[model samples]
Target: MRRYLLCTVLFFTMISCVVNRTVVAKPILFDAEREQLTLEYMRDRYGLETSSSAIDPKMIVLHWTVIPTMEESYKAFYEAKLPNWRPDLENVSGLNVSSQFLIDQDGTIYQLLPETTMARHVIGLNHCAIGVENVGGGEGLPLTRKQLKSNVWLVKYLKEKYDIDYVIGHYEYTNFEGHELWLEKDSAYRTVKTDPGEHFMKKVRKATRKLEFKLVPEK
Candidate 1:
Protein backbone atom coordinates (compact mmCIF):
# COMPACT_ATOMS: atom_id res chain seq x y z
CA MET A 1 0.00 0.00 0.00
CA ARG A 2 2.86 2.41 0.78
CA ARG A 3 4.58 1.68 -2.55
CA TYR A 4 1.40 2.45 -4.49
CA LEU A 5 0.98 5.68 -2.56
CA LEU A 6 4.53 6.71 -3.35
CA CYS A 7 4.04 6.04 -7.08
CA THR A 8 0.86 8.13 -7.12
CA VAL A 9 2.63 10.99 -5.41
CA LEU A 10 5.49 10.87 -7.95
CA PHE A 11 3.03 11.06 -10.86
CA PHE A 12 1.40 14.18 -9.49
CA THR A 13 4.82 15.76 -8.87
CA MET A 14 5.74 15.31 -12.53
CA ILE A 15 2.46 16.85 -13.62
CA SER A 16 3.08 19.84 -11.37
CA CYS A 17 6.43 20.58 -12.98
CA VAL A 18 4.81 20.81 -16.43
CA VAL A 19 1.70 22.66 -15.30
CA ASN A 20 3.64 25.22 -13.27
CA ARG A 21 5.36 26.70 -16.31
CA THR A 22 3.59 29.84 -17.60
CA VAL A 23 2.57 29.66 -21.26
CA VAL A 24 0.07 32.37 -22.14
CA ALA A 25 -2.03 31.09 -25.02
CA LYS A 26 -3.36 34.15 -26.84
CA PRO A 27 -4.48 32.79 -30.17
CA ILE A 28 -4.53 35.30 -32.99
CA LEU A 29 -5.87 34.99 -36.54
CA PHE A 30 -6.88 31.36 -36.20
CA ASP A 31 -10.02 30.39 -38.10
CA ALA A 32 -11.09 29.19 -41.51
CA GLU A 33 -9.19 32.07 -43.12
CA ARG A 34 -5.98 31.26 -41.28
CA GLU A 35 -6.44 27.59 -42.02
CA GLN A 36 -6.73 28.35 -45.72
CA LEU A 37 -3.64 30.53 -45.52
CA THR A 38 -1.74 27.59 -44.11
CA LEU A 39 -2.94 25.45 -46.94
CA GLU A 40 -1.98 28.00 -49.59
CA TYR A 41 1.46 28.40 -48.05
CA MET A 42 2.07 24.70 -48.18
CA ARG A 43 0.84 24.21 -51.72
CA ASP A 44 2.34 27.31 -53.38
CA ARG A 45 5.60 27.87 -51.52
CA TYR A 46 6.45 24.25 -50.83
CA GLY A 47 4.73 22.59 -53.80
CA LEU A 48 3.15 20.33 -51.21
CA GLU A 49 0.01 18.78 -52.61
CA THR A 50 -1.93 18.88 -49.38
CA SER A 51 -5.41 20.42 -49.30
CA SER A 52 -5.71 20.24 -45.51
CA SER A 53 -3.87 22.11 -42.74
CA ALA A 54 -2.97 19.15 -40.54
CA ILE A 55 0.72 18.78 -39.59
CA ASP A 56 2.77 16.29 -37.63
CA PRO A 57 5.65 18.38 -36.31
CA LYS A 58 9.09 16.81 -36.12
CA MET A 59 11.33 19.86 -35.49
CA ILE A 60 11.31 23.23 -33.71
CA VAL A 61 12.77 26.21 -35.59
CA LEU A 62 13.70 29.33 -33.66
CA HIS A 63 13.45 32.88 -35.03
CA TRP A 64 13.68 36.53 -33.92
CA THR A 65 11.01 38.91 -35.23
CA VAL A 66 12.80 42.19 -35.97
CA ILE A 67 9.52 43.92 -35.09
CA PRO A 68 10.56 45.38 -31.71
CA THR A 69 7.44 45.63 -29.55
CA MET A 70 5.29 42.68 -28.52
CA GLU A 71 2.14 44.35 -29.87
CA GLU A 72 3.66 45.00 -33.28
CA SER A 73 5.08 41.50 -33.44
CA TYR A 74 1.65 40.12 -32.67
CA LYS A 75 0.05 42.36 -35.29
CA ALA A 76 2.55 41.33 -37.94
CA PHE A 77 1.60 37.69 -37.61
CA TYR A 78 -2.05 38.15 -36.66
CA GLU A 79 -3.05 38.70 -40.24
CA ALA A 80 -4.27 35.72 -42.22
CA LYS A 81 -2.96 37.19 -45.47
CA LEU A 82 0.48 38.43 -46.40
CA PRO A 83 1.05 42.14 -46.92
CA ASN A 84 2.25 43.58 -50.22
CA TRP A 85 5.50 44.99 -48.78
CA ARG A 86 7.39 41.78 -49.39
CA PRO A 87 7.66 41.86 -53.16
CA ASP A 88 10.58 39.47 -53.01
CA LEU A 89 8.38 36.87 -51.40
CA GLU A 90 5.42 37.37 -53.75
CA ASN A 91 6.49 34.59 -56.07
CA VAL A 92 7.08 32.29 -53.13
CA SER A 93 4.01 32.50 -50.87
CA GLY A 94 0.94 34.71 -51.04
CA LEU A 95 0.01 33.88 -47.44
CA ASN A 96 1.35 35.95 -44.58
CA VAL A 97 4.16 34.40 -42.57
CA SER A 98 3.51 33.38 -38.97
CA SER A 99 4.87 31.29 -36.10
CA GLN A 100 3.22 28.98 -33.61
CA PHE A 101 4.63 30.90 -30.62
CA LEU A 102 6.25 34.27 -29.86
CA ILE A 103 8.55 34.92 -26.91
CA ASP A 104 8.53 38.49 -25.59
CA GLN A 105 11.62 40.43 -24.56
CA ASP A 106 10.62 39.98 -20.91
CA GLY A 107 10.48 36.18 -21.34
CA THR A 108 6.71 35.88 -21.62
CA ILE A 109 5.69 33.12 -24.03
CA TYR A 110 2.53 33.49 -26.13
CA GLN A 111 0.97 30.75 -28.19
CA LEU A 112 0.01 32.36 -31.50
CA LEU A 113 -1.24 29.07 -32.93
CA PRO A 114 -1.47 25.40 -32.09
CA GLU A 115 2.05 23.95 -31.62
CA THR A 116 1.66 21.09 -34.09
CA THR A 117 0.06 23.22 -36.80
CA MET A 118 2.30 24.53 -39.57
CA ALA A 119 3.73 28.04 -39.23
CA ARG A 120 5.32 29.79 -42.22
CA HIS A 121 8.39 31.22 -40.51
CA VAL A 122 11.12 29.00 -41.97
CA ILE A 123 11.97 28.12 -45.51
CA GLY A 124 11.96 24.53 -46.86
CA LEU A 125 11.22 22.85 -43.52
CA ASN A 126 7.81 24.39 -42.68
CA HIS A 127 6.10 21.13 -43.53
CA CYS A 128 7.69 19.43 -40.51
CA ALA A 129 8.83 22.33 -38.29
CA ILE A 130 7.15 24.29 -35.52
CA GLY A 131 8.46 27.87 -35.48
CA VAL A 132 9.06 29.87 -32.29
CA GLU A 133 9.69 33.58 -32.94
CA ASN A 134 11.45 35.73 -30.37
CA VAL A 135 10.17 39.33 -30.28
CA GLY A 136 13.36 41.34 -30.84
CA GLY A 137 16.81 40.97 -32.39
CA GLY A 138 17.55 44.19 -34.21
CA GLU A 139 20.51 46.56 -34.00
CA GLY A 140 21.40 47.17 -30.32
CA LEU A 141 18.39 45.04 -29.25
CA PRO A 142 19.94 41.70 -28.42
CA LEU A 143 18.00 38.73 -27.04
CA THR A 144 17.66 38.56 -23.24
CA ARG A 145 18.60 35.92 -20.66
CA LYS A 146 14.97 35.63 -19.58
CA GLN A 147 14.04 34.72 -23.15
CA LEU A 148 16.77 32.08 -23.12
CA LYS A 149 15.46 30.46 -19.96
CA SER A 150 11.92 30.45 -21.28
CA ASN A 151 13.07 28.80 -24.51
CA VAL A 152 14.83 26.07 -22.56
CA TRP A 153 11.71 25.38 -20.53
CA LEU A 154 9.46 25.47 -23.59
CA VAL A 155 11.72 23.11 -25.54
CA LYS A 156 11.73 20.58 -22.75
CA TYR A 157 7.96 20.86 -22.40
CA LEU A 158 7.47 20.32 -26.13
CA LYS A 159 9.87 17.37 -26.23
CA GLU A 160 7.74 15.70 -23.60
CA LYS A 161 4.57 16.43 -25.59
CA TYR A 162 5.61 15.61 -29.16
CA ASP A 163 7.88 13.43 -31.23
CA ILE A 164 10.26 16.36 -31.73
CA ASP A 165 13.50 15.39 -33.42
CA TYR A 166 15.39 18.67 -33.83
CA VAL A 167 15.63 22.23 -32.47
CA ILE A 168 17.28 24.58 -34.98
CA GLY A 169 17.78 28.30 -35.49
CA HIS A 170 16.27 29.82 -38.66
CA TYR A 171 19.71 30.22 -40.19
CA GLU A 172 20.46 26.54 -39.72
CA TYR A 173 17.32 25.44 -41.60
CA THR A 174 19.06 25.19 -44.93
CA ASN A 175 21.19 22.44 -43.48
CA PHE A 176 18.16 20.17 -43.45
CA GLU A 177 18.01 20.18 -47.24
CA GLY A 178 18.53 16.76 -48.92
CA HIS A 179 17.81 15.13 -45.55
CA GLU A 180 14.59 13.12 -45.33
CA LEU A 181 12.77 16.07 -43.77
CA TRP A 182 13.43 18.47 -46.63
CA LEU A 183 10.11 18.84 -48.51
CA GLU A 184 10.35 21.94 -50.67
CA LYS A 185 10.12 21.16 -54.37
CA ASP A 186 11.89 24.17 -55.82
CA SER A 187 15.54 23.68 -54.93
CA ALA A 188 16.41 27.21 -56.08
CA TYR A 189 13.89 28.84 -53.74
CA ARG A 190 15.54 29.97 -50.51
CA THR A 191 15.74 32.97 -48.23
CA VAL A 192 18.79 34.33 -46.36
CA LYS A 193 18.40 35.23 -42.67
CA THR A 194 20.54 36.02 -39.60
CA ASP A 195 17.78 36.06 -37.07
CA PRO A 196 17.98 34.60 -33.55
CA GLY A 197 21.67 34.87 -34.39
CA GLU A 198 24.74 32.77 -33.66
CA HIS A 199 25.32 33.90 -30.07
CA PHE A 200 21.65 33.48 -29.15
CA MET A 201 21.48 30.00 -30.66
CA LYS A 202 24.68 29.02 -28.81
CA LYS A 203 23.05 29.82 -25.47
CA VAL A 204 19.86 27.90 -26.31
CA ARG A 205 21.86 24.90 -27.49
CA LYS A 206 23.94 24.90 -24.31
CA ALA A 207 20.81 25.03 -22.18
CA THR A 208 19.05 22.31 -24.18
CA ARG A 209 22.05 20.06 -24.92
CA LYS A 210 20.69 17.32 -22.70
CA LEU A 211 17.47 17.06 -24.77
CA GLU A 212 19.33 15.14 -27.50
CA PHE A 213 17.65 16.86 -30.49
CA LYS A 214 19.09 16.02 -33.88
CA LEU A 215 21.78 18.33 -35.28
CA VAL A 216 21.03 19.63 -38.80
CA PRO A 217 22.08 16.93 -41.23
CA GLU A 218 24.81 17.46 -43.82
CA LYS A 219 23.96 17.28 -47.51
Candidate 2:
Protein backbone atom coordinates (compact mmCIF):
# COMPACT_ATOMS: atom_id res chain seq x y z
CA MET A 1 0.00 0.00 0.00
CA ARG A 2 2.85 2.44 0.81
CA ARG A 3 4.61 1.65 -2.50
CA TYR A 4 1.42 2.17 -4.48
CA LEU A 5 0.78 5.54 -2.87
CA LEU A 6 4.37 6.69 -3.55
CA CYS A 7 4.08 5.67 -7.22
CA THR A 8 0.85 7.59 -7.63
CA VAL A 9 2.38 10.70 -6.07
CA LEU A 10 5.39 10.50 -8.41
CA PHE A 11 3.16 10.22 -11.49
CA PHE A 12 1.14 13.26 -10.55
CA THR A 13 4.32 15.24 -9.83
CA MET A 14 5.67 14.47 -13.30
CA ILE A 15 2.46 15.55 -14.89
CA SER A 16 2.52 18.81 -12.97
CA CYS A 17 6.08 19.53 -14.11
CA VAL A 18 5.10 19.10 -17.76
CA VAL A 19 2.03 21.26 -17.46
CA ASN A 20 3.88 24.06 -15.63
CA ARG A 21 7.00 24.03 -17.80
CA THR A 22 9.08 27.19 -17.96
CA VAL A 23 8.78 29.45 -21.01
CA VAL A 24 11.95 30.27 -22.95
CA ALA A 25 12.78 33.94 -23.33
CA LYS A 26 13.32 35.10 -26.92
CA PRO A 27 12.69 38.83 -26.76
CA ILE A 28 12.28 41.07 -29.79
CA LEU A 29 13.39 44.69 -30.09
CA PHE A 30 11.43 46.83 -27.62
CA ASP A 31 13.48 50.00 -27.41
CA ALA A 32 12.27 53.50 -26.73
CA GLU A 33 11.34 53.89 -30.40
CA ARG A 34 9.12 50.83 -30.24
CA GLU A 35 7.48 52.08 -27.04
CA GLN A 36 6.74 55.44 -28.67
CA LEU A 37 5.30 53.74 -31.73
CA THR A 38 3.09 51.59 -29.55
CA LEU A 39 1.71 54.59 -27.78
CA GLU A 40 1.11 56.32 -31.09
CA TYR A 41 -0.77 53.29 -32.39
CA MET A 42 -3.02 53.16 -29.33
CA ARG A 43 -3.82 56.83 -29.62
CA ASP A 44 -4.37 56.90 -33.36
CA ARG A 45 -6.08 53.57 -33.93
CA TYR A 46 -8.03 53.06 -30.72
CA GLY A 47 -8.46 56.66 -29.66
CA LEU A 48 -6.71 55.78 -26.40
CA GLU A 49 -4.22 58.47 -25.61
CA THR A 50 -2.26 57.17 -22.69
CA SER A 51 1.16 58.12 -21.33
CA SER A 52 2.27 54.54 -20.80
CA SER A 53 1.93 51.48 -23.06
CA ALA A 54 0.69 49.21 -20.26
CA ILE A 55 -2.63 47.41 -20.79
CA ASP A 56 -5.05 45.70 -18.40
CA PRO A 57 -5.59 42.48 -20.31
CA LYS A 58 -9.15 41.16 -20.51
CA MET A 59 -8.77 38.72 -23.44
CA ILE A 60 -6.27 36.33 -24.98
CA VAL A 61 -5.88 36.06 -28.78
CA LEU A 62 -4.35 33.00 -30.40
CA HIS A 63 -2.59 33.30 -33.77
CA TRP A 64 -0.48 31.37 -36.28
CA THR A 65 2.64 32.98 -37.75
CA VAL A 66 2.02 31.67 -41.29
CA ILE A 67 5.81 31.98 -41.49
CA PRO A 68 7.62 28.62 -41.69
CA THR A 69 10.13 28.79 -38.85
CA MET A 70 10.56 30.36 -35.42
CA GLU A 71 13.64 32.30 -36.55
CA GLU A 72 11.82 33.83 -39.50
CA SER A 73 8.81 34.77 -37.37
CA TYR A 74 11.11 36.35 -34.77
CA LYS A 75 12.82 38.42 -37.48
CA ALA A 76 9.49 39.64 -38.78
CA PHE A 77 8.72 41.18 -35.42
CA TYR A 78 12.28 42.29 -34.55
CA GLU A 79 12.09 45.91 -35.56
CA ALA A 80 9.76 48.76 -34.63
CA LYS A 81 8.82 49.87 -38.15
CA LEU A 82 6.57 47.89 -40.45
CA PRO A 83 8.50 45.88 -43.01
CA ASN A 84 8.10 46.62 -46.70
CA TRP A 85 6.53 43.20 -47.11
CA ARG A 86 3.62 44.22 -44.86
CA PRO A 87 2.26 47.19 -46.79
CA ASP A 88 -1.31 46.51 -45.76
CA LEU A 89 -0.48 47.30 -42.12
CA GLU A 90 1.76 50.31 -42.78
CA ASN A 91 -1.22 52.59 -43.28
CA VAL A 92 -2.34 51.90 -39.73
CA SER A 93 0.96 52.55 -37.91
CA GLY A 94 4.69 52.17 -38.30
CA LEU A 95 4.80 49.90 -35.26
CA ASN A 96 5.67 46.41 -36.44
CA VAL A 97 3.33 43.52 -35.63
CA SER A 98 4.13 41.48 -32.53
CA SER A 99 2.76 39.38 -29.68
CA GLN A 100 3.52 38.97 -26.00
CA PHE A 101 4.25 35.24 -26.33
CA LEU A 102 5.46 33.06 -29.24
CA ILE A 103 5.32 29.26 -29.35
CA ASP A 104 7.58 27.16 -31.57
CA GLN A 105 6.51 24.05 -33.48
CA ASP A 106 8.07 21.83 -30.83
CA GLY A 107 5.90 23.33 -28.06
CA THR A 108 8.62 25.64 -26.75
CA ILE A 109 7.10 28.93 -25.63
CA TYR A 110 8.90 32.29 -25.99
CA GLN A 111 8.12 35.57 -24.35
CA LEU A 112 8.52 38.26 -27.00
CA LEU A 113 7.57 41.09 -24.66
CA PRO A 114 6.11 41.74 -21.24
CA GLU A 115 2.70 40.12 -20.68
CA THR A 116 0.79 43.34 -19.95
CA THR A 117 2.44 45.51 -22.59
CA MET A 118 0.18 46.17 -25.56
CA ALA A 119 1.02 44.35 -28.80
CA ARG A 120 -0.57 45.05 -32.16
CA HIS A 121 -2.00 41.60 -32.84
CA VAL A 122 -5.81 41.54 -32.90
CA ILE A 123 -7.76 44.34 -34.52
CA GLY A 124 -9.98 46.49 -32.25
CA LEU A 125 -8.92 44.61 -29.13
CA ASN A 126 -5.24 45.47 -28.85
CA HIS A 127 -6.01 47.67 -25.89
CA CYS A 128 -6.89 44.68 -23.74
CA ALA A 129 -5.87 41.46 -25.55
CA ILE A 130 -2.79 39.35 -24.93
CA GLY A 131 -1.52 37.63 -28.07
CA VAL A 132 0.03 34.16 -28.33
CA GLU A 133 1.46 33.38 -31.75
CA ASN A 134 2.42 29.89 -32.90
CA VAL A 135 5.43 29.52 -35.21
CA GLY A 136 3.86 27.89 -38.29
CA GLY A 137 0.55 27.53 -40.09
CA GLY A 138 1.22 28.06 -43.79
CA GLU A 139 1.34 25.58 -46.66
CA GLY A 140 3.20 22.49 -45.49
CA LEU A 141 4.15 23.96 -42.13
CA PRO A 142 1.03 23.12 -40.17
CA LEU A 143 0.99 23.71 -36.43
CA THR A 144 2.06 20.58 -34.57
CA ARG A 145 0.22 18.72 -31.82
CA LYS A 146 2.99 19.78 -29.47
CA GLN A 147 2.09 23.38 -30.22
CA LEU A 148 -1.54 22.70 -29.32
CA LYS A 149 -0.57 21.27 -25.96
CA SER A 150 1.70 24.22 -25.33
CA ASN A 151 -1.11 26.65 -26.22
CA VAL A 152 -3.48 25.01 -23.76
CA TRP A 153 -0.89 25.22 -21.01
CA LEU A 154 -0.16 28.82 -21.92
CA VAL A 155 -3.83 29.83 -21.84
CA LYS A 156 -4.26 28.35 -18.39
CA TYR A 157 -1.10 30.02 -17.16
CA LEU A 158 -2.14 33.43 -18.45
CA LYS A 159 -5.65 33.08 -17.08
CA GLU A 160 -4.22 32.37 -13.67
CA LYS A 161 -1.91 35.39 -13.86
CA TYR A 162 -4.39 37.91 -15.19
CA ASP A 163 -8.09 38.66 -14.92
CA ILE A 164 -8.70 37.19 -18.35
CA ASP A 165 -12.34 36.76 -19.33
CA TYR A 166 -12.24 35.60 -22.94
CA VAL A 167 -10.06 33.52 -25.28
CA ILE A 168 -10.57 33.90 -29.02
CA GLY A 169 -8.76 33.15 -32.27
CA HIS A 170 -7.42 35.86 -34.53
CA TYR A 171 -10.11 34.96 -37.08
CA GLU A 172 -12.82 35.60 -34.53
CA TYR A 173 -11.79 39.15 -33.58
CA THR A 174 -14.37 40.74 -35.86
CA ASN A 175 -17.22 39.18 -33.92
CA PHE A 176 -16.50 41.67 -31.11
CA GLU A 177 -16.64 44.66 -33.46
CA GLY A 178 -19.55 46.39 -31.76
CA HIS A 179 -19.27 44.64 -28.40
CA GLU A 180 -18.17 46.64 -25.34
CA LEU A 181 -14.69 45.19 -25.63
CA TRP A 182 -14.34 46.54 -29.17
CA LEU A 183 -12.54 49.89 -29.32
CA GLU A 184 -11.27 50.54 -32.82
CA LYS A 185 -12.09 54.00 -34.14
CA ASP A 186 -11.79 53.20 -37.83
CA SER A 187 -14.52 50.80 -38.94
CA ALA A 188 -13.10 50.69 -42.49
CA TYR A 189 -9.67 49.61 -41.26
CA ARG A 190 -10.78 46.05 -40.57
CA THR A 191 -8.96 43.14 -42.20
CA VAL A 192 -10.23 39.58 -42.67
CA LYS A 193 -8.18 36.85 -40.98
CA THR A 194 -8.30 33.03 -41.05
CA ASP A 195 -5.44 32.15 -38.81
CA PRO A 196 -5.16 29.32 -36.22
CA GLY A 197 -8.13 27.75 -38.03
CA GLU A 198 -11.53 26.72 -36.76
CA HIS A 199 -10.52 23.15 -35.93
CA PHE A 200 -7.59 24.38 -33.86
CA MET A 201 -9.74 26.83 -31.91
CA LYS A 202 -12.46 24.26 -31.28
CA LYS A 203 -9.93 21.92 -29.71
CA VAL A 204 -8.47 24.66 -27.57
CA ARG A 205 -11.85 25.93 -26.49
CA LYS A 206 -12.98 22.41 -25.62
CA ALA A 207 -9.91 21.78 -23.51
CA THR A 208 -10.31 25.10 -21.70
CA ARG A 209 -14.11 25.14 -21.42
CA LYS A 210 -13.89 24.32 -17.72
CA LEU A 211 -12.28 27.71 -17.12
CA GLU A 212 -15.64 29.34 -17.73
CA PHE A 213 -14.39 31.98 -20.17
CA LYS A 214 -17.07 34.14 -21.68
CA LEU A 215 -18.44 33.08 -25.09
CA VAL A 216 -17.61 35.02 -28.23
CA PRO A 217 -20.11 37.78 -28.89
CA GLU A 218 -22.50 37.28 -31.81
CA LYS A 219 -21.82 39.27 -34.94
lDDT winner: 2
Number of the top TM-score candidate: 2
For residues 1-219, write the lDDT of model 2, one tens digit per residue.
999999999999979977779899888999999999999999998888799999999999999999988999999988988999999888889999999999999999999999999998998999999999999895678889999999999999999999999999999999998899889999898888988989899999998999999999988
Candidate 2: where is the Cα deviation over 4 Å?
A: 1-10
Candidate 1 TM-score to native: 0.87
lDDT at residue 81 of model 2 (Cα atoms): 88
Each candidate: what lDDT? Answer: 0.85, 0.92
TM-scores, all candidates, are 0.87, 0.94
Q: Where is the poorest 10-residue window by lDDT in model 2?
A: 135-144
Assess the local accuracy of residue 128 in candidate 1 as a C-alpha lDDT between 0 and 100: 85
lDDT of 1 by residue, 1-219 (tens): 999999999999977855787889988787788788788778876777787776888998889998788999999888777777776876776667889999999999999888878888888888888889998895877888888888888888889988999998898888887888887888898888888898888888898899888777865
Looking at candidate 1, the ten consecutive residues that score lowest on lDDT are: 86-95
lDDT of 1 at 150: 81
List where candidate 1 sits over 4 angstroms from the true fold.
Answer: 1-19
